[model samples]
Each structure stands twice: as C-alpha cells, then as structure tokens.
Target: MTKVFIIKFSIFILFSFILSTVSAFAQVDVEKMAKNFNIYLAFPEKHFQLKDGKYSGGTSPQDFANVSIEKIVIKDLNGDGLDDAVLVTVGNYGGSGGFYELTALLSTSSGLVQTNSIVLGDRINIKKIQVHSPEAHSPPELGLIKQNFEILIYMLKHKPNDPACCPTEPTMECFTIHKNKLIPCKEAPEPPVVKKPALYLYPIKNQEVEVEINPKGKVLKTIPEYREKWKVYVTKNGKINGKYNYLFYETTLNAPIPEYQRGWVVSHKELSRWFDVTLTKFGLNKREIRDFKAYWLNELPQFPYYEIRPLDTQFVEENLTIKINPKPATVIRVILHFKGTDTPSKLEEPAIITNVRKGFTAVEWGGILENSPNSDIKPQAKYSFLAQDTGVVVLRAIDLREHKLSIKLSSNGCTDKKALKSIVKKLEGINSQVPHYEITLIREKPDRCKALISEGTTIVYDLKEEFGINTKLPYTVTVKNPIYPLITDEPYFQFFPKKELKPKPVEEDMSLKEHLIKATVRAIEMEIKRYETSQQRDKEDKIDRLRNEIEKFNKMKPEDYILGYPNGAESSMEMFTYGPLMPPIHRQVEAIIEEPLKIGSILKLTTMTKSGPFYHIAGINENIDIAKELKQGRYRMKLYLVYKREYFGFIQNYYVYIAEVEKQ
Candidate 1:
C-alpha cells in the first residue's frame, strides 16, 4: 500500500511540473514588456502637469499633466508562436484636452523589441483597441496585414469645432509591423480640390481690357489697362480678391521710369492696346497668357526699328565715339550694329561698364571688325543696349546717330606665354632610356629569361631543368650592391616545391618531398622576418649616428675640420666598387650604385644562400672597351659554383656561364 502511494504522489508532482513550465513560457509582464520595447507612452511626465492636484509654488499648471497607461495586449505575431505586446497610452493636461498614442513591441529571443510608436491625435480619446489574428493557411507569412495579425484602434479625433464634452465622429485606424516599422494599414485620404478664378481678355474697339471671371463664366470685375504705345511702365499694387495675379502695364506719358524696379505686372490686355488682337473674349491658360504678354510687352516693340544702320553712308571716318549718362554705381551695356560687308578695323567688343560716379562715359568704336582673326561679322549687324539707369547716349561711329546699339562676343581662357614656354622646355628634356637585358643558359636546349632592370628590381629564376635536373624548386633573383649585406638570410635552394604546386604524395619519396617543402617554406618565412627586423634596426642606428655627427659639427668651430685634415682620413678611405651588386640566386636585393658607374671600377659579383656560398666571382673590371663589346655582341662570363647542395647539385663541377646582352 505504501509503494502505491509513492507512485501516485510522483505522478501528481510530474503533472504539476509540466503545467508550471508551460505557464512560465506563456506568461509575459505587460509593463516590463512595454518598457523593453521602448514604447512611447503619452505619459503626463513628458509634458505639463498639475502638482499634487494643485499648482506648485513655481511650476506652471498647464505645463504639468497626469499620464496613464490605458491598455496592453499580448498575442502571437508573425505565427512565430511567441507572444508580442501592443501598448495604448494617454495623457491628460489639467484642462479638458489630452493626447493619445499607440506602440508595438516584437518578441525576440533576447527580449522584447520595440517595432513602432505613432501618435494617433492630439486631444483624442481612444474608444476601443482590438488585435485581429486570422486563421493560418497552408503556409504562413509575416507582414503588416496580409498574413500577420494587426491592431485596430477606434478613436475620436478632436476637431477645432468639437465641443468639450464629445468629439463629432469616431475614426478607425489599423496598424501592424511592416519592414520592422509600425505603419497605418490604410493609405491617407487625398486632398480636397481647390477652384481658381478664370482670366479673360476682351478687345473693345481701340482699347483692350482684362477681366476676372468665375468658374460659371460670369464677369467679376475689369482690371485697369495701359494704353500708351511708347514708354509704357508696369506697376504691381498688392493682390486683389478674385483678380488675376499678374504684372499690369501702366502708361505714363510724361513721367520718367524708375531704375531696377521689378515685380511689376505686364498683362496681354495692356499690351493689346499697341498691337492688334484677333480675339474679343478669349480664355487662355496661364502659360499661354504669360507668353502672349511677354511677346507684346517685351519683344514686339522692337520690331519696327529692325533696320541695320548703313556703314559708308552713316560713318565717313574710321573711328566713332559714343557718350552715355547712367546713374552712379550702375552698369550700361552697349551693343553695335554694322551695315554692309565692310568690317571694322578695330572695335572694342561690346561690354557692360559700371559707372562709379555720375558723369558722361565715353565709348570709342573702330568700325565693323572681325570677331576673331579668322571670322568676320555679317554686313547687316544690329546692336542693342540694356541700361540699368535712365540715360541718353550719343554714338558717333563715323557720323551715325542711334539711341540703342547689340554686339556678341565670345569668352575664352587667355594664354600665358611664360607657362607655355616652361611646358615646352620640360617636354624637350624627358628621359628616353630604358635598360633591359636577356640571358640564355646553354644546356641540352636553351633556358632563356628576359627582364627590364632598374634600381630595387626583383627577378624570379625558374631553374627546375638547369643542368638536366627536373627538381621542383622556388627561386628569386635580385640585383644587389656588393658593398651592402644580403637583404635576406633564406637559402637560395629549396628542397620542395611551392604550396600552389599541389604536388601529390603517392609514395614514400613523394611524401618526403612534400614535408621538406613545407619545412623549407617555414624556414624561409622566419629568415625573412629576421632579416627585415635587422635591416630596420641598422637603418635606425645609422640615422642616429648621422644625427650625432651633425650635432657635433654644428657645435665645432669652422677651423676644426675645415682648416685641418679630418681624423682617420687614411683609415676611412677604402677601395670599393661603384656599380650594382650581382643579384642573389633566390632573393630580393636593392641595387645601391651610390654614384654613376666609373669607367674602371671593379665590381665583385657573388651569389650565396643562408646554407653557404654557392658562387663568387671577384675583381670584375668595368671599362669602356668591355661596355662597347657587350653593346655590340653577347659575351659569356664563367660562374664558379661552390658548396653545392641536392637541389643545385647538378651544376657542381659543371661550367655554368651567363651573358649580359643588350637588345638592338
């Protein structure tokens, strides 16, 4: 009986455990969830509020308010089986008005993530909030509304005319997660259409009148029209109710026009007085009316005076002078017109000149001139002037009298003689030397390699078949200065091929070769690092020594070294080669030819590896005769190999020669 009781109690405990686990996973704290999502609640603390239900000593009553979290709902979103939270919040200022907002939080593995927060309306009341989760289909998708759940919020949007007790109507809005953002489910309504007043132009006998008409075609009012043919001015009074907003030209017979006074209206109706009109009451679009106004007011007045002034008949002399009177600090542009094919010998290109002080400005003209050295102006050329201030000009181009003159000139960059000369000199002195060499090692066939050599250049040598040995090895050759130590400590010989070769190891010998190759590469890396560090240290030490010597020299009296023989003069003078060092078999070395090669300097060429020396040739004489012989034909120099190894063992006891041949 006791055993049965124990079994039954254990079963009850297991059942309770399972139920607790499920509850723990399903339960979510709404407040904590909202805070985790960074939900924007219209809480009273963010704005003005009343303190302690009364005004504080210095705090404003309207500036403080009471805020509260209204409602929160949690449901599975995106069919992920994880509950997401939505928050509704409201804030009430001391008065009757308040604010409403909605926030959404997505449930993530780490925590609740805030998706979106949007303000619904100011002084609004939220009536209802509901989460609509539809039934899942064969395949579930995540979005704002198509497949995922959405939150519908019913609210009363406060209007300006709404009474304090209640808003006029209820507004419905839906929101959901879209691209990680909370957006409205419905698009915003379109704007209301606005009606504009129609403008009409009427021709009444000799006068033209402009009138404003409503959409029904009834005349509203007639606008004032300018009637003068010559000397017409436009004046803009402020905007009028239902009147067309355009510039209206006004005719003033005796009054002078002001300078640079823009913003005036010039209408087609006012211009129709000077020009003939074909329509009585025409309905025109804004752009068409603007074009018609510009044509009559700005362009049509100049048509009657299109005649080009005759050259020989008007001007008897070669030169002419024009005097213009413009207001102070104003620019006057003068243009010239030429008659007949007789081009002017010398004419100052038309330009706008500013007059700093009020007085008569003199402009001289050399009759009908060419625009350029190769181009000439046409015979019937016309000129016009656009002046800022009211002024009269007397132009005497030989003896022609005209009120206005137009000249066109081309603008381009001016040439600088000094800059051009400097460029020409540089072009004439460019270097044309490109030194290159090709060497062919004679064997069963021929192993040939060609290269362009310069200071600090590196060359790679493929010596797999040299001396009739077909061993795979990596090699690099560099031109070096003999005086300087070798740039690298890695051996010129490698027992194994490079990593990119992908050599197969089927037998014991093949496996051994692969292992040796890896070992050689590792050794090469370490040696390269060691050599680079050593070179950097050497350069730093040399720089320090030079700095110290400079300091010592600066402190010394001029007579110390300049007046007497320097210390260790004889000991420091050592015989050295000035030409480039012979490059290593498989390494990079800088060619340090300190000065240009002298005719008789001896160059020592040596090739060695970290293991030991492989080849050394001393006392190579540099002479004009040898250079001439090399330039004419190829000459092979014998290489003496020493301390030969497995990879390079075939070359041992064999005469290896290389030629320094230049291409024709």
Candidate 2:
C-alpha cells in the first residue's frame, strides 16, 4: 500500500499545543478567548462562543463544521499595551475544502472578545503575523482608528491559472483594525480547489438508508469517523449541514475498473458537457451530477482528450459490499474511470442502465482520475480480485506429494492446464514445528475449446525443488483463508499415478471414438431441439445440417472403432455427473480439432460437468498414461468443443479452454 499524506498543519498543531499549555499555566486573555469568546464575522454578528479553543456548530446539521484555533501569536495591538492575540483558525465541513480564517482576540475591560475576521481562503499558508504600530500615524478614509493597529500577514497564495492543489505564488496582506473589525488592506485570493477520489452516498428522505460499506481500497478520510457504517438523517436535498451532510469518503483507485471495455473518448472542453449527459443517463439527480463535476473540474489535469469508461454498476455495488438497512428500492453507483489520452479514441459503446428514484433510493457517484495509463500511484491491493476474467472454476481439491503441492481445481469442459498460473511463498512460521507456506492459484487464461477429459485440472508447485522445503517433513499451507494441513508423511493420499480405481463392467466398454461420437451426437441433438422452439427461422438450416451429421455417428458400430482404452482404465473419459449430455454454450463455436498431433501433446482434458459455459469439468491425470497407450505409432486424436461462463449479468467473461496444447 503506497500512502501519500500531506501534513497540512503539522507545525501549526505542535506550536498551538505548546502555546495552549503555556497559556493555561497563567490566566490570560488568551485563556478567556479559548473558553467563551465572541467572534464577529458579519453584521448582526453570529457569536461562535467557543469552548476550549474549539467549536462545532452551524445553521443546521447539513452545514455543520468543526473549528479549531490552529496557531496563535501574542502581541500588543490597538496601541493598548495589554497583550492581544492573533489567531489562525481552521474549520472543515463534510466535504473537501477546509476554511481557514485570520482573526484576533482583543483585550478590553469586558475581557477577551473575538473581532471581525477575514476569510484567508481554503488551504492558505500563514508564514508569520506581526503587529506594526508607528509612533505617529494619520487615519485614512475608511472609518479608521478605534482599535488602530496594523497587521502584516505573510503567506503563500495561488496564482491565476494555477490548479487548486498547488499554490506556488508568494504574497502578503496588510490589515488594520477599524471600529474593532479587522479590515483587509488588500484583496483576498480565490480559494484553492482541493481534490481526491470522493465517493458520496445519498439516501433521500429522513435517513431512509443505513449504509455499511467495505470499500475496495483504504479510506483516506471520512466525515464523522466511519466506524463500520453511517446512519445520518439526510434531507431530501442531500445536504444535512454546511459542514456535514450526506456520508462521504475518499480513496485512491489503483487501476481502471476492469468491467469498462467501452466508453466515449472526450476532449478537455467536453468534460463538463460529457459529465452532464452521461451522469443523467446513468441515473444521477441534478444535485448529484452537479456535485460530481464541481469536485473534480477545478483540479482536473489539462489533457488534449481523455478515454473515460464506467465499471458495471452491479459489480461496484457487490464488490464494494454495500449493505443498507430498510434496503433501498433502487441502488445506483456510478464511477467514471478515466485516463488522459492524446486524441479521441474509437471504441465500442457500453450499455447504459438508467435508474429511477422511488420510495427509498440510494445514490452514489464517484470517479477515478488517472492522468496517464501508467502513473506511479500504487494503491493498496485491498480488493479480493482485480476482475472476473478467470475461467469457470468453483472448487479446489488439494494434495501434497514428493514435496510438491497439487491443487485440482473444478473446471468446466474448457479448462486447460496451460491457462492457469500459481505462486507459492514460504511464510514466517506461526508454530515452531509446523512450517507455513502461502499459495494462490489464478486462472490467467480461460479454456475456450479443447479435448476435455472428465477429470478436473491439476496445477502443481514444487515446495522442495522450487521453494526449498524439506520433503520428509509435514507442512501447512494457506490457500485463501483455509490452512491446509498437508500430511505428506503418509503416502496414501498421493493419487497422481492414475490408479485403476474403477469397477469391472459386466459388458464390454465403448471405445474412445465411440464415446466421443455418442456424447457429441446427444449434445448436438439436445442443442438442435432447443433452437427448434425459438422464433428465429434462419437457424433451421444449421439445425437440419447438424442433425444429419449426428445420425452418421449414431449408425456406426462401437466395435468398429479401433482406438479403445482398457475397460475401466482411468484414462477413459467419464461423466463428472450422470444424466443427459450437456451442450456447448454457443452452437456457432462448436468444433472438432484433430490436426495430426501425437498423444504426447495431450496434457490435460476436462469433462463437461455442467451445462455450457458455467463449465465444471471432472479432471484426472492421464497425460502420461494416454501417451504410453498410443506409443509406437504417430496417431491423431480428436477433441471436443465446450464452453463455460460464470453467468454474471452483462459480463460473459468468455474463455476458450484449450488442450495441454490444442486451441492454437
């Protein structure tokens, strides 16, 4: 996890604490100001009446803010000899900007009272504050001289055309007390726009939704301290207070959202208009849409154009694991993942799903702004998985033999051994006697079509040869959350030798060629029967032609096929489940491969366990065994075509399961 933190007031805080403690030792006007002091900002002045140098209050909860005196300098102002206090106060609301103000606490017969202050703008840096009183001076036109002392404020201000984040210009302000109010002798600079990935939650109507969110990344900041969840009585306007309103948090997204394969390529000038149209299409209200734009536009890096896309909303909601009580009737989460580009990119458009705000609705809008395809921002990998591109695999059966750990993963018929990847690392031990190791298996590539043996796919990791583990000793491995206790000392669990664990059949078993032909015919017939009921008429010719091809195999005798595995041998294809044969997901891609390849080239075969694409395959190790059975002659073997899908909505995540070498 790479964390970038800007310590905004580190020095100011330390100095404030020291000054506060020193002032506490002796009763002074500063102490009086720290307690119950009055602040006059505008006419009919609103009294802050601060306590303990800190105050929290506003017109309402929606505009609620927290204010603290960050730094203070003691000096005699008004030429009154009694020491007056110059204070820098910081106030932060529910959102990004922090309001910094320059104020004074003057000593009078009535005690310390806060005078009229000046808005120093957001994120203004104060270098020093000095009180300058000449031996003789004349009053100017603007009602001068009741609390007549000049104040010199040296600070850093943002220059014109500067991004709200970095204010590099050095400037100073001169002020004088006029009728007890601090009047700025110069004009104030515009506030700098602060930015980060801000995700806001809206539950329109009297806190109708109680939300609990486990984000895919670490939270940088959250108002009201996000402890598990937030339950705020939000107003219909989505504003509860000036300082606090709807729940919000900030996090850095490490990469582009994987589900976004298509979106618009827009120029810098088009960002505002693009956000309006796209956000409206994705179901954001007027207020939500406006807020999203306001938060990023000021600091958006200038680019010729940008490639912007959105993650599947359902994917975001589920992956973020948003839980709401009195559940929202509709949940709409929009995140614009964008990268700066040189020009408009030609790409496919994604389908947009619009939502309506009814009853109790939950709306969330955020964005990931990446200046380039590859930036140095390395966010924490707090997410479970990056994307759902891996093939159909749902279960794992693990074993360890010869200091090697083998994981047999459940695959649909398309699962191939080459498509999978695994990594192993020896972890620091939790127990002195038991060695601990961690392993993860990811299907980097998915099987689309291949000769599938019914047994599941097996991937191996050599602990002794690769990671230097003792072969004779027992060890423990962590896979996901489970600690697999591998009792390698017992040789009984090692099943990789293709053990003949099958029962003897009463009749002669079918040959390899006959088995393939029967399953193919049955599957093809089932597929043809399915499309027969569809309204489309063009597929009629394909159905008829496929039916004619299946009948030829049905008419052939099983004894005529010379390629036969020993009856009940482990090398023979078997059903992972029994019943009717399952067909391919796409009838158009159903194929057969027999390009003069030797049996030695056949490394893995997965049997079709479930119906097309939600593929679960039964696997067995027969690569070496099958190779030996076909030796002495260069023979060509036929393979089956199958598909598997996780069936996630709008995301098929299709993969071609190939052979130990087939799909090329």
Top lDDT hit: 2
Q: Distance from true position, residue 108, model 2, in Å?
A: 81
* Candidate No. with top TM-score: 2
Q: Give the CA lDDT, 0 to 100, for residue 159 in model 1.
A: 54
The runs of at least 3 residues in candidate 2 whose Cα sits more than 4 Å from the true structure, single-residue gaps closed, are: 1-209, 241-243, 252-256, 372-664
lDDT of 2 by residue, 373-471 (tens): 122232212211112246223434677766677766544455544665444555457688777866555566655443543345666777777556675
lDDT of 2: 0.52
Local distance difference test values of all predictions, in order: 0.31, 0.52
lDDT (tens digit, per residue) of candidate 1 on 427-511: 1112333222122211121111222111112222332322121223222221111122212122432321222122232233333
TM-score of each: 0.23, 0.27
Question: Local error of candidate 2 at 252, Å?
Answer: 4.6
